[model samples]
Target: MMRIVTAGYSRHTRSYYSNQAHGLKYFLVRLQTEGFCQALVNGTLYTIRPGDLLLCKPGDSYELMVQLGSNEPPSGDYFLSVELNEWMLEWWEDYKQEVKLNVGVDEMLISIWRHLVYEKRRVKDSNPDIMDYLCRSILLHMNRLISGGVSSNPYERSVSNQIKMFIEKNATEPITLRDVSTAVGLSVSRASQLFKEAFNQSVMDYAIEVRLSIAKERILIGGSTLQEVSFLCGFANYTHFNRSFRLRYGMSPSEYRRQVRPQ
Candidate 1:
């Protein structure tokens, strides 16, 4: 699993410098949020402004330089020291000596980072896992920024893709084991076994989940009545839709809509 050894946010004024560089012991990320910042990444000087990030491996030398913006008291930056899992390390190895990511100052990433710093100080919060999730999110977002797209895990990509596509495309209509099996070029028994192994649920059960998901979107949109929702989501009868919805979400369709409505 991925790990964030430590993280913090800080600010600096003009004329601050560190002549001696610490020996690299952890993967480091320093992101500038305001004003101007600079760093020598892999022996090249870079002037990083708001939303620019610096990434370094375990053995690379790094240094920070910051200049305050006009009307701003100090330059702002956030730092993270991380321990990547084996797969993540392998992913990192594919990059060059130094990489710069331009994420462009996202609010969600800022919110997540603030919460992570708050949780780090509250030792009794009993929610340490939030930091791990947030750190992973930041790293993934940086990867997206650098790579120019999102990437999926290879193991997850290899599992029951054809069956899932068929279910999503046909969830509004009647679907069957024979149809799915034929589409995937597998016998019905073999298809059933493979789907179960990959998704831990039978094909029909996943189909219901997909259908219910569609119904939920429609319900939340509030452009349809309960009767329309039942038929539109592929339920044979309104009573069956009500029962299945209650079983999965513990509320009637109408009740769910009300609960999720904006206050």
Candidate 2:
């Protein structure tokens, strides 16, 4: 179980500074969702921007400064102060938490945080279990976003990664090239070109690969028939799914499942 001490949104129009030189008392997770600011992270002051995530453990020196120049947008962020239990501690130790990570402002991740914030605001009526699960979901999703590889060109890398993440999250649903493009605010041709340049595979191909991977897992897990697996994994029909699976694995879905499963 995890306990959230405080969770809310903050926006600074002028200038603001939060200094905790003596260190913090609880785990702090902050996501910069709009504009930009500066923060002392790992003994160095860093310019934090939208899509930047800040993770701080207890007793870590944390400082945030928001300096707004004339005609500049205000700094905005979502923050949560958490008290970790045993399970949360285990999850924390499993990953090397950096002072700051550029995990891109993923909508799904923000949605989870928003829900957690709303539940926390419920005060006396807040359900502990719901808050706990929502917090865990945010952390887990952040982990995945942070694990993605970054390229040399920051702008290109961010756009390419946004496309990849969108495909991954929606692969099980009916997605198209236009859908991918719209999600990342890029034209269809541009999105396709960028994805191929970054990943060496076309967007549609990667989507098919993701779909087949899901289909394979469903086949191995049983309970779902081949046709059902195909449909559930976003395949238009069993024939198309069979063809794609065989092309990727060199065996029919049923054959692969049989060989991998017990006799």
Candidate 3:
């Protein structure tokens, strides 16, 4: 089971305050919807603008500094944090190969995110399954553009097609490197290596990402409880779900529901 947790949006007002320099932390995916900020990772400065995404790995020294840009107040920037658990690790691998940071938001992703924002606003408590489904879809939509490049390498194209088919065929099953290997007619280790090379993710890692993505939908839209969702989603137990969910959202499953539920 992939034990990932997510943190929802909580806006922070910045008047040019400096955060204390800290050691490396968990993976940080910064989505800039408004305003601009700069992140200094080990003396290298990177600028962030609207639609830009930034990744920060744990244990890496970094600092976040925000300032007022052309826009006044800059209060609408959205920042979310999710711990990169096993499933995320796989997603990251594929993502690193296929997607580039700071790329403009694809129309599909924009639509999904708009829906998520709308849903989040109306519900005081959210169904864990629904939240998971929506969030996972948002993430995948962002990655799909990265995966669908114009490259013509036969091997890369093959890998991409296989992955797509695999995801569609087994949306409800636990995806495994071994399964991909068998489907692709390659040794397990060889399959892992090629997948990492072409998609920037091991077969197992991508599998977890797919499973998590589907589980989120099943739980949320299917109206399944955490236990049922976990069991059906390929998690070993509820404890595993709690840990992963907390890490990804910065709140437990129950808390997420309470936070998103309409009063």
Candidate 4:
């Protein structure tokens, strides 16, 4: 059985989540109950809605946004953290690494989440064995859903997915398009062309997107200085970071930080 780290519900209004894998240690499972959200996993984007759930292995950077305009309403969801074991780790390697997997709409799963959260809130007052069993149940069910929905040629698709995952995992490093090309065992043109066909974006552009997403998340969570955030996110300097940030997001990093910070 897996260890239940933490479980809670998140309610957001006109909000967004930008997260990096820099020092993450636990595997994560999140369930969406309401509103619309989009998640970028390994350079590929997924549009998430009610009844959607996602699983992220350790060291995978992901960005989630609730496409809420000024008049849009709030969204709610539940998320849980758990310790990974050898069995699950082995399972991940075999399955297609699709982070945003769907389990359809199931109220039974929601009930399990509620029960887990209630137990988490109870602390030592709760039974560890029961919590562990519930947590294992969720993981097993999600893994089953993902495994059961496999594509016909996962071995081939996994190559493209591996390329995207490599970029996301190493986005903070000073890696080049050539490095990505070589890592994928494709020629420069082939790698670039294949990536474009799959993601509809150039490899370099996706790398920049990954870096910027991680930078935003770091600023919000770590509260690191602008220069530090830029450097940590693989920008050559703050000026380039500022320019890219403004171009990609229409707001400077500092301004966005202030917007998301508590008032």
Task: Name the weakest run of 10 consecutive residues (lDDT summed) in model 3.
Answer: 1-10
- Candidate 1, residues 82-154, lDDT tens digits: the string is 7756755876776655567665555556767877778767767636577778777876755644543222322
lDDT string, candidate 2, 35-149, tens digits: 9999895587888989888878888888899989899998889998988578667767855456777877777788999999999999589999999999999889887766554
lDDT of each: 0.73, 0.85, 0.59, 0.75
Cα lDDT tens digits for candidate 3, 62-101: 6777766554557344433456566667767755532116
Candidate 1 contains a number of clashing pairs equal to 0
Candidate 3's C-alpha runs over 4 A off are 1-20, 69-76, 95-100, 114-124, 148-263
The lDDT, on a scale of 0 to 1, for candidate 1 is 0.73
Top of the candidates by lDDT: 2
Judged by lDDT against the true structure, how good is candidate 3?
0.59
Please, what is the TM-score per model? 0.53, 0.79, 0.45, 0.50
lDDT, residue 186, model 4:
81
Please report how far candidate 3 places residue 69 from its true position, in Å.
Answer: 6.2
**Which candidate would rank higher by lDDT, 1 or 2?**
2
Q: Write the residue-wise lDDT of candidate 4 on 1-263 in tens digits.
A: 66778898988886777666353477777888778788776667888776677777776667777767888767888898777787567656754456765555444466777888898889558888888878767767655444432333333333455567679878999998889888878888877776676567888888999999999899889658989999999998899999999999999998998898856
* lDDT of model 2, residue 129: 97
The predicted structure with the larger TM-score, 1 or 4, is 1
What does candidate 4 score in Cα RMSD to the true structure?
19.9
**Candidate scoring better on lDDT of 2 and 3:** 2
The lDDT, on a scale of 0 to 1, for candidate 4 is 0.75
